[model samples]
Target: MHEVSIMQDMLQLAEENLRKSGCTEIRRISLRVGLLSGVVPEALSFAFDVLKSGTSAANATLEIESSPSLFSCGACGTESWYESLRFECPECHGILILQKGGTDLELTQMEVSSTD
Candidate 1:
Protein backbone atom coordinates (compact mmCIF):
# COMPACT_ATOMS: atom_id res chain seq x y z
CA MET A 1 0.00 0.00 0.00
CA HIS A 2 1.05 3.57 -0.62
CA GLU A 3 0.55 4.31 3.06
CA VAL A 4 3.66 2.27 3.77
CA SER A 5 5.74 4.53 1.58
CA ILE A 6 4.07 7.61 2.97
CA MET A 7 4.75 6.49 6.52
CA GLN A 8 8.33 5.76 5.60
CA ASP A 9 8.81 9.26 4.27
CA MET A 10 7.19 10.78 7.33
CA LEU A 11 9.47 8.78 9.62
CA GLN A 12 12.48 9.86 7.60
CA LEU A 13 11.56 13.48 7.93
CA ALA A 14 10.85 13.14 11.62
CA GLU A 15 14.11 11.34 12.18
CA GLU A 16 15.98 14.05 10.30
CA ASN A 17 14.46 16.72 12.51
CA LEU A 18 15.12 14.70 15.66
CA ARG A 19 18.74 14.18 14.73
CA LYS A 20 19.22 17.84 14.00
CA SER A 21 17.85 18.71 17.43
CA GLY A 22 19.95 16.06 19.19
CA CYS A 23 16.92 14.06 20.18
CA THR A 24 17.00 10.30 20.15
CA GLU A 25 13.44 9.56 21.17
CA ILE A 26 10.37 10.52 19.23
CA ARG A 27 7.37 10.92 21.48
CA ARG A 28 4.58 11.92 19.19
CA ILE A 29 3.86 12.58 15.54
CA SER A 30 0.81 14.54 14.54
CA LEU A 31 -0.68 14.62 11.09
CA ARG A 32 -3.54 16.47 9.43
CA VAL A 33 -5.29 14.27 6.91
CA GLY A 34 -8.05 15.48 4.64
CA LEU A 35 -11.08 13.47 3.67
CA LEU A 36 -10.32 14.01 0.03
CA SER A 37 -6.62 13.25 0.39
CA GLY A 38 -7.41 9.65 -0.75
CA VAL A 39 -5.59 8.24 2.23
CA VAL A 40 -7.17 5.62 4.46
CA PRO A 41 -6.44 6.52 8.08
CA GLU A 42 -6.58 2.94 9.30
CA ALA A 43 -4.19 1.83 6.63
CA LEU A 44 -1.84 4.64 7.44
CA SER A 45 -1.93 3.80 11.10
CA PHE A 46 -1.23 0.16 10.41
CA ALA A 47 1.64 1.18 8.19
CA PHE A 48 3.07 3.36 10.91
CA ASP A 49 2.82 0.55 13.42
CA VAL A 50 4.59 -1.84 11.14
CA LEU A 51 7.28 0.50 9.86
CA LYS A 52 8.36 2.19 13.07
CA SER A 53 10.26 -0.79 14.38
CA GLY A 54 14.02 -0.28 14.82
CA THR A 55 13.67 3.40 13.91
CA SER A 56 13.91 6.57 15.90
CA ALA A 57 10.10 6.73 16.02
CA ALA A 58 9.77 3.20 17.41
CA ASN A 59 8.12 4.53 20.52
CA ALA A 60 6.31 7.42 18.96
CA THR A 61 2.56 7.83 18.94
CA LEU A 62 0.81 8.79 15.71
CA GLU A 63 -2.00 11.32 15.89
CA ILE A 64 -4.28 11.90 12.93
CA GLU A 65 -6.60 14.85 12.63
CA SER A 66 -9.25 14.57 9.98
CA SER A 67 -10.17 17.58 7.85
CA PRO A 68 -13.50 17.76 6.11
CA SER A 69 -14.14 18.70 2.53
CA LEU A 70 -15.34 22.29 2.25
CA PHE A 71 -17.34 23.93 -0.49
CA SER A 72 -18.33 27.51 -1.08
CA CYS A 73 -21.16 28.71 -3.22
CA GLY A 74 -20.05 31.12 -5.89
CA ALA A 75 -23.50 32.69 -6.18
CA CYS A 76 -24.76 32.78 -2.62
CA GLY A 77 -21.45 32.90 -0.71
CA THR A 78 -22.55 29.99 1.41
CA GLU A 79 -19.92 27.78 2.88
CA SER A 80 -20.42 24.19 3.91
CA TRP A 81 -18.40 21.23 5.10
CA TYR A 82 -18.97 17.62 4.19
CA GLU A 83 -17.37 14.27 4.74
CA SER A 84 -17.92 13.44 1.09
CA LEU A 85 -17.33 15.40 -2.08
CA ARG A 86 -20.02 17.94 -2.95
CA PHE A 87 -20.65 19.80 -6.17
CA GLU A 88 -23.85 21.71 -5.56
CA CYS A 89 -24.83 24.09 -2.80
CA PRO A 90 -27.86 23.10 -0.75
CA GLU A 91 -29.10 26.65 -0.60
CA CYS A 92 -30.07 28.68 -3.69
CA HIS A 93 -29.12 25.72 -5.87
CA GLY A 94 -25.86 27.45 -6.69
CA ILE A 95 -22.76 25.85 -8.05
CA LEU A 96 -20.29 25.04 -5.32
CA ILE A 97 -16.56 25.53 -5.64
CA LEU A 98 -13.97 23.63 -3.75
CA GLN A 99 -12.16 25.52 -1.02
CA LYS A 100 -8.76 24.98 0.50
CA GLY A 101 -9.02 22.77 3.57
CA GLY A 102 -9.28 19.15 2.44
CA THR A 103 -7.29 17.31 -0.20
CA ASP A 104 -4.08 17.60 1.81
CA LEU A 105 -2.00 15.30 3.96
CA GLU A 106 0.38 17.22 6.15
CA LEU A 107 2.65 16.40 9.07
CA THR A 108 1.77 19.08 11.57
CA GLN A 109 3.83 18.42 14.67
CA MET A 110 6.35 16.10 16.31
CA GLU A 111 7.50 15.83 19.91
CA VAL A 112 10.95 14.51 20.64
CA SER A 113 13.21 13.99 23.63
CA SER A 114 16.96 14.28 24.03
CA THR A 115 18.57 11.29 25.69
CA ASP A 116 21.05 13.16 27.82
Candidate 2:
Protein backbone atom coordinates (compact mmCIF):
# COMPACT_ATOMS: atom_id res chain seq x y z
CA MET A 1 0.00 0.00 0.00
CA HIS A 2 0.98 3.66 -0.17
CA GLU A 3 1.64 3.55 3.57
CA VAL A 4 4.74 1.52 2.89
CA SER A 5 6.14 4.30 0.78
CA ILE A 6 5.13 6.82 3.39
CA MET A 7 6.83 4.86 6.14
CA GLN A 8 9.92 4.51 4.03
CA ASP A 9 10.06 8.25 3.63
CA MET A 10 9.53 8.75 7.34
CA LEU A 11 12.25 6.28 8.18
CA GLN A 12 14.59 8.02 5.79
CA LEU A 13 13.93 11.33 7.49
CA ALA A 14 14.36 9.83 10.94
CA GLU A 15 17.61 8.23 9.94
CA GLU A 16 18.89 11.48 8.52
CA ASN A 17 18.02 13.29 11.71
CA LEU A 18 19.56 10.58 13.84
CA ARG A 19 22.78 10.80 11.90
CA LYS A 20 22.89 14.54 12.21
CA SER A 21 22.32 14.38 15.93
CA GLY A 22 24.71 11.46 16.49
CA CYS A 23 21.87 9.36 17.76
CA THR A 24 21.97 5.60 17.51
CA GLU A 25 18.55 4.72 18.82
CA ILE A 26 15.14 6.09 18.24
CA ARG A 27 12.66 5.79 21.09
CA ARG A 28 9.61 7.29 19.46
CA ILE A 29 8.28 8.86 16.31
CA SER A 30 5.27 11.01 16.83
CA LEU A 31 2.94 11.83 13.98
CA ARG A 32 -0.09 14.02 13.49
CA VAL A 33 -2.55 12.46 11.07
CA GLY A 34 -5.55 14.38 9.87
CA LEU A 35 -8.88 12.70 9.30
CA LEU A 36 -8.95 13.86 5.68
CA SER A 37 -5.29 13.10 5.03
CA GLY A 38 -6.34 9.92 3.13
CA VAL A 39 -3.74 7.83 5.00
CA VAL A 40 -4.87 4.84 7.01
CA PRO A 41 -3.40 4.58 10.50
CA GLU A 42 -3.60 0.82 10.71
CA ALA A 43 -1.82 0.39 7.41
CA LEU A 44 0.80 2.91 8.41
CA SER A 45 1.44 1.09 11.68
CA PHE A 46 1.74 -2.23 9.89
CA ALA A 47 4.15 -0.75 7.41
CA PHE A 48 6.26 0.69 10.23
CA ASP A 49 6.37 -2.69 11.95
CA VAL A 50 7.39 -4.46 8.78
CA LEU A 51 9.93 -1.91 7.62
CA LYS A 52 11.71 -0.96 10.87
CA SER A 53 13.76 -4.10 11.18
CA GLY A 54 17.54 -3.49 11.29
CA THR A 55 17.05 0.24 11.03
CA SER A 56 17.69 3.07 13.46
CA ALA A 57 13.99 3.02 14.30
CA ALA A 58 13.79 -0.73 14.79
CA ASN A 59 12.83 -0.24 18.41
CA ALA A 60 11.03 2.99 17.90
CA THR A 61 7.40 3.37 18.86
CA LEU A 62 5.10 5.04 16.38
CA GLU A 63 2.75 7.42 18.12
CA ILE A 64 -0.09 8.82 16.08
CA GLU A 65 -2.25 11.75 17.11
CA SER A 66 -5.45 11.91 15.11
CA SER A 67 -6.79 15.28 14.04
CA PRO A 68 -10.48 15.64 13.42
CA SER A 69 -11.89 17.19 10.29
CA LEU A 70 -13.14 20.72 10.88
CA PHE A 71 -15.35 22.99 8.86
CA SER A 72 -16.65 26.56 8.97
CA CYS A 73 -20.06 27.75 8.01
CA GLY A 74 -19.86 30.11 5.09
CA ALA A 75 -22.95 32.03 6.05
CA CYS A 76 -22.69 32.10 9.85
CA GLY A 77 -18.92 32.07 10.43
CA THR A 78 -19.28 29.19 12.85
CA GLU A 79 -16.73 26.38 13.09
CA SER A 80 -17.27 22.85 14.27
CA TRP A 81 -15.86 19.34 14.21
CA TYR A 82 -17.13 16.90 11.65
CA GLU A 83 -16.58 13.22 11.14
CA SER A 84 -18.68 12.74 8.05
CA LEU A 85 -18.57 14.27 4.58
CA ARG A 86 -21.45 16.56 5.36
CA PHE A 87 -20.77 20.12 4.34
CA GLU A 88 -23.80 21.73 5.85
CA CYS A 89 -23.44 24.14 8.72
CA PRO A 90 -25.11 23.09 11.92
CA GLU A 91 -25.89 26.62 13.06
CA CYS A 92 -27.31 28.36 10.02
CA HIS A 93 -27.72 25.50 7.57
CA GLY A 94 -25.26 27.23 5.30
CA ILE A 95 -22.63 25.61 3.10
CA LEU A 96 -19.63 24.57 5.16
CA ILE A 97 -16.09 25.09 3.97
CA LEU A 98 -12.91 23.66 5.35
CA GLN A 99 -11.41 26.39 7.46
CA LYS A 100 -8.49 25.05 9.48
CA GLY A 101 -6.45 21.94 10.02
CA GLY A 102 -7.15 18.42 8.67
CA THR A 103 -5.89 17.09 5.33
CA ASP A 104 -2.34 16.80 6.66
CA LEU A 105 0.13 14.06 7.57
CA GLU A 106 2.95 15.52 9.56
CA LEU A 107 5.88 14.28 11.63
CA THR A 108 5.59 16.26 14.83
CA GLN A 109 8.37 14.98 17.08
CA MET A 110 10.90 12.26 17.75
CA GLU A 111 12.60 10.95 20.85
CA VAL A 112 16.08 9.59 20.33
CA SER A 113 19.15 8.46 22.22
CA SER A 114 22.64 9.49 21.39
CA THR A 115 25.36 6.94 20.64
CA ASP A 116 27.35 8.13 23.67
Candidate 3:
Protein backbone atom coordinates (compact mmCIF):
# COMPACT_ATOMS: atom_id res chain seq x y z
CA MET A 1 0.00 0.00 0.00
CA HIS A 2 0.90 3.65 0.01
CA GLU A 3 1.56 3.41 3.72
CA VAL A 4 4.77 1.56 2.85
CA SER A 5 5.98 4.54 0.87
CA ILE A 6 4.88 6.87 3.63
CA MET A 7 6.76 4.85 6.24
CA GLN A 8 9.83 4.80 4.06
CA ASP A 9 9.72 8.57 3.84
CA MET A 10 9.23 8.87 7.59
CA LEU A 11 12.13 6.51 8.29
CA GLN A 12 14.33 8.43 5.92
CA LEU A 13 13.53 11.65 7.69
CA ALA A 14 14.04 10.06 11.09
CA GLU A 15 17.40 8.67 10.08
CA GLU A 16 18.51 11.99 8.69
CA ASN A 17 17.50 13.81 11.83
CA LEU A 18 19.06 11.22 14.08
CA ARG A 19 22.32 11.30 12.20
CA LYS A 20 22.42 15.06 12.39
CA SER A 21 21.94 14.84 16.13
CA GLY A 22 24.60 12.14 16.46
CA CYS A 23 22.01 9.61 17.52
CA THR A 24 22.26 6.02 16.43
CA GLU A 25 19.26 4.44 18.05
CA ILE A 26 15.66 5.48 17.75
CA ARG A 27 13.33 4.80 20.64
CA ARG A 28 10.09 6.05 19.27
CA ILE A 29 8.48 7.91 16.44
CA SER A 30 5.43 9.87 17.44
CA LEU A 31 2.88 10.73 14.80
CA ARG A 32 -0.35 12.68 14.83
CA VAL A 33 -2.83 11.30 12.34
CA GLY A 34 -6.13 13.00 11.62
CA LEU A 35 -9.37 11.20 10.98
CA LEU A 36 -9.51 12.50 7.41
CA SER A 37 -5.83 12.10 6.62
CA GLY A 38 -6.66 8.95 4.59
CA VAL A 39 -3.79 7.13 6.27
CA VAL A 40 -4.76 4.00 8.13
CA PRO A 41 -2.98 3.60 11.46
CA GLU A 42 -2.88 -0.18 11.39
CA ALA A 43 -1.56 -0.23 7.87
CA LEU A 44 0.99 2.40 8.69
CA SER A 45 2.15 0.38 11.67
CA PHE A 46 2.42 -2.72 9.59
CA ALA A 47 4.35 -0.83 6.97
CA PHE A 48 6.75 0.49 9.55
CA ASP A 49 7.23 -2.96 10.98
CA VAL A 50 8.01 -4.37 7.57
CA LEU A 51 10.20 -1.50 6.43
CA LYS A 52 12.28 -0.85 9.53
CA SER A 53 14.54 -3.79 9.00
CA GLY A 54 18.29 -2.88 9.00
CA THR A 55 17.42 0.74 9.74
CA SER A 56 18.14 2.81 12.81
CA ALA A 57 14.44 2.71 13.65
CA ALA A 58 14.26 -1.07 13.65
CA ASN A 59 13.62 -1.06 17.37
CA ALA A 60 11.70 2.14 17.47
CA THR A 61 8.11 2.16 18.57
CA LEU A 62 5.57 3.84 16.38
CA GLU A 63 3.21 5.92 18.45
CA ILE A 64 0.14 7.31 16.76
CA GLU A 65 -2.16 9.97 18.16
CA SER A 66 -5.56 10.01 16.49
CA SER A 67 -7.29 13.30 15.83
CA PRO A 68 -11.00 13.65 15.41
CA SER A 69 -12.62 15.28 12.44
CA LEU A 70 -14.06 18.67 13.37
CA PHE A 71 -16.34 20.98 11.50
CA SER A 72 -17.68 24.46 11.95
CA CYS A 73 -21.16 25.63 11.16
CA GLY A 74 -21.23 28.13 8.36
CA ALA A 75 -24.32 29.86 9.62
CA CYS A 76 -23.82 29.80 13.41
CA GLY A 77 -20.02 29.47 13.81
CA THR A 78 -20.43 26.43 15.99
CA GLU A 79 -17.92 23.61 16.06
CA SER A 80 -18.59 19.92 16.29
CA TRP A 81 -16.70 16.64 16.09
CA TYR A 82 -17.79 13.71 13.97
CA GLU A 83 -16.55 10.30 12.98
CA SER A 84 -18.52 9.80 9.77
CA LEU A 85 -18.64 11.59 6.45
CA ARG A 86 -21.89 13.36 7.23
CA PHE A 87 -21.43 16.93 8.34
CA GLU A 88 -24.37 18.66 9.88
CA CYS A 89 -24.29 21.54 12.30
CA PRO A 90 -25.80 20.55 15.59
CA GLU A 91 -26.40 24.07 16.79
CA CYS A 92 -28.22 25.86 13.99
CA HIS A 93 -28.67 23.08 11.42
CA GLY A 94 -26.42 24.97 9.06
CA ILE A 95 -24.01 23.54 6.53
CA LEU A 96 -20.82 22.48 8.28
CA ILE A 97 -17.41 23.22 6.91
CA LEU A 98 -14.08 21.88 7.99
CA GLN A 99 -12.55 24.57 10.17
CA LYS A 100 -9.60 23.13 12.05
CA GLY A 101 -7.60 19.94 12.38
CA GLY A 102 -8.20 16.65 10.54
CA THR A 103 -6.86 15.68 7.14
CA ASP A 104 -3.29 15.97 8.40
CA LEU A 105 -0.40 13.60 8.88
CA GLU A 106 2.39 15.03 10.99
CA LEU A 107 5.49 13.69 12.64
CA THR A 108 5.31 15.32 16.04
CA GLN A 109 8.48 14.05 17.70
CA MET A 110 11.15 11.39 17.75
CA GLU A 111 12.82 9.85 20.74
CA VAL A 112 16.39 8.82 20.09
CA SER A 113 19.55 7.88 21.89
CA SER A 114 22.64 9.94 21.20
CA THR A 115 25.80 7.99 21.63
CA ASP A 116 28.78 10.13 22.44
List model 2 lDDT by residue over 1-116, tens digit each. Answer: 99999989988998898888887999899888887888998999999999999998989999988877778888998888875566888788999998667787988899999667
In terms of lDDT, the best-performing candidate is 1
Judging by TM-score, tell me the better candidate of 1 and 3. Answer: 1
- Summed over model 2, clashes come to 0
Clashing residue pairs found in predicted model 2: none
Candidate 2 local lDDT, residue 46: 97
Better of 2 and 3 by lDDT: 2
Task: Check candidate 1 and list the clashing pairs.
Answer: none
Give TM-scores for every candidate, taking all chains together and pairing residue i with residue i. 0.81, 0.81, 0.80
For each candidate, C-alpha RMSD in Å?
2.5, 2.5, 2.6
Q: Candidate 3, residues 1-116: lDDT per residue as tens digits?
A: 98989889889989998989887899899988888888999999999999998998989999998877778888998887765554677777889998667887888899999555
The whole-model lDDT of each prediction reads: 0.89, 0.87, 0.86
Residue 68, model 3: Cα distance from true site in angstroms? 3.9
